[model samples]
Target: MSISNGIGNLQGLSNPVTPASATVQTGKEEQIKSSVSLAPGAVKTTPVTDQTVISSTSELLTRALSGSDVRLDKIQPLQAAIAAGTYQVSSSDLADKLITSLLK
Candidate 1:
């Protein structure tokens, strides 16, 4: 089974490679969209229609806002992309934090 940082049916799967495989094909309208599967019951072919990407993002956000430890391996690529300038942080967010800190 395949897992993303926020989404997927996961179905008690613990390993990466098996008789089955899943890959995430992230996109614009859909951020961390997953595609590709394998084997008989391989990737738990649930539509994931009920679960929007927003739900997934919100779940991860709830964990973050709670200050819980997250799986770093799941986030390493994003960190690298940001560091490499392939990704960006909005100036609005940065400025908001700076102003909030000054007010505090």
Candidate 2:
């Protein structure tokens, strides 16, 4: 078999570009712009109508994140009691709490 090539092979193919029709309008309306003339030394302030409020949970979380995880009020008394050799903890209660945390 021999290869054939010529413009005759492309006779049925349509042109890729399309020309615009005369019925379509191409003109656009001109927009009118005016300048504002304010009095001398006049200041314009925009009024704010919306305000953002922080939820209680978000405020508490922000405070907790900024402050230490350990509370000073709870830790101070415990530290003092331990230093005075009066701090007592039950073994069963501590073990139960540990096991409960592990299960969770």
State TM-scores per candidate. Answer: 0.28, 0.34
lDDT tens digits by residue: candidate 2, 13-66: 453222234234344321111122234465757788998898999989998889
Error of 2 at 96 (Å): 0.9
Winning model by lDDT: 2
Q: For this target, which candidate reaches the highest TM-score against the unseen true structure?
A: 2
Clashing pairs in 1: none
Give the Cα RMSD of candidate 1.
28.9
In angstroms, the error of model 2 at 63 is: 6.3
Model 2 ranges off by over 4 Å: 1-64
Summed backbone clashes in each candidate are: 0, 0
Residue range 1-104, candidate 1, lDDT tens digits: 95588546567555434332244335643322333324445565566556435678898888889995778887998999988989877999999999999999
* Candidate 1 wrongly placed segments (more than 4 Å): 1-68
Candidate 2, after superposition: displacement of residue 18 in Å?
28
